[model samples]
Target: MAGRIVVGVDGSEPSLKALTWAAGQAALTGDALQTVIGWEYPASWAALMPGVPPEFDPERLAKQILDEAIDQALTPAQAAAVTRTVVGGNAPQALLDAAEGATLLVVGDRGRSGFTAAVLGSVSLHVTQHAPCPVVVVRGRTGA
Candidate 1:
């Protein structure tokens, strides 16, 4: 690989799969792997709802999620991969922004829900359409 391999993670099973695939690709290509988690806080009004804490920080949550995902996705040998968390208006925008100079951008087919078929998630579809670099949508190893 000529540059870093960027992978988008969202704390979902499919995203974890993407992370794993990216890590392997990076190792094989002798390129750095970057795991990016994107998050956006709910509006102030939404946070003001009953029982919702006002001090919640979306960026912090994103970082925490990314760290956890990285821990789960990488093996001990792949621990040297670089990881990053991005706070953006949306996942697609953050991923696209990170893909600017990347050798390849990896993402999951479906995340959290809507995995009844092989369809890509909205963010992944958007990234595939607009990413500056090549995009890879990783599904399960068994092709489920």
Candidate 2:
């Protein structure tokens, strides 16, 4: 059986960079590349929207973000080979849950600034500390 590499994508610049890195790693190692994305209602969802909009769909948006990230980061063949996973809830938990039995987990730094920029972003920090498998935090400037 082939190993699996799980990567979190949130459609951010850093996430796109992470997706590219994960795809390249998967290509080199022949691991199954799975891109995971998550979405949740904001804490003030009810306050923001008294009634749900007919066209509002967080799950569908998550899937589109995942797909766009893949398209932005990978070649057609690479994108085709990717497994897109959309989950409900936050990114860190989604990544950890998807990483079960994975050979590796990868994430972006979330492109923080100042003192925070020198350190891992909250999601990256959480996953690095708690991932079920070896985690690789892709670090670099965004849009570079």
Candidate 3:
């Protein structure tokens, strides 16, 4: 069994599927599962409206989104074996950072993309190319 299995979640259907797959793998291998949600504040807005009040704490928002996504993705029984992490950055970099020393890093085939034809988004491709450990891109029924 591996020591740890890490999965990236972004509250998308494919990401949820990836989380589910990672959870099953963790249970099968009796390894700890780390579910990570990566988020970055929009730089363009901050730059455009420098004087506007900050609407939210980026770290807190990240955690809240991650927690909600995890709750929605995992059942109570399956959630017990999982640990949650919220990172401040884009998906690929955050996943790579969290994958250090991890046995495996799991991610969705695609995420929050409006482009219908874009199968695997840039983040997944980047992570697959650069993650330190083996990376698994979970493809759902959409075949992305």
Candidate 4:
């Protein structure tokens, strides 16, 4: 059976870079490529405001982000061949779940809004340590 390659995208520059790199790898390997993105409500939303959820739908936002990332990162044919998934809850766990039965899992070193000083973002670190398959953490400084 042909293998699958799962890549995590979070709408960050590094994520876009990872997506592009993963797409090229998928094309070369003839493996199915799937992009997974995770989203969750801030803890404060549950703790401070119990009943009312934010009017902005995080799920929709996640989907939009995935779509935009795909557009920005991949060629038309590559984007058309890719599958997009938006998962709810923690990013690392969501990526790990998606990587099940896949040949490879790829992620960016850091995501959007993370601490700038961190060498590796928590999600990437966790997935690299615990992913079901081999993991690739794409890391580099983006040119201005």
lDDT of each: 0.81, 0.87, 0.83, 0.90
lDDT of 2 at 100: 100
- Which pairs of residues have clashing backbones in candidate 4? none
What CA RMSD would you report for each candidate?
A: 2.5, 2.8, 2.4, 2.5
Those runs of model 4 whose alpha carbons end farther than 4 Å from true positions after fitting are 46-54, 142-144
In model 3, the runs with Cα more than 4 Å from the true position are: 47-55
Error of 4 at 124 (Å): 0.5
- lDDT per residue (tens digit) for residues 1-144 in model 2: 679999989887778888889898998999999999988898999898897887899999889888888998999999999999999998889999999999999998873222443567888988999988999988757442
Candidate 3 residue pairs in clash (backbone atoms < 3 Å)? none
Clashes of each: 0, 0, 0, 0
For residues 56-133, could you state the per-residue lDDT of candidate 1 as single tens digits?
Answer: 777787788888888888886685547675666678898888888999999998766545664677888889999999
Q: Write model 4 residue lDDT over 4-70, tens digit each, in one string.
A: 9999999998899899889989988999999999998787877766776558688998999999999
lDDT of 3 by residue, 86-113 (tens): 8878878889999999999999888876
RMSD of 1: 2.5
TM-score of each: 0.86, 0.89, 0.86, 0.91
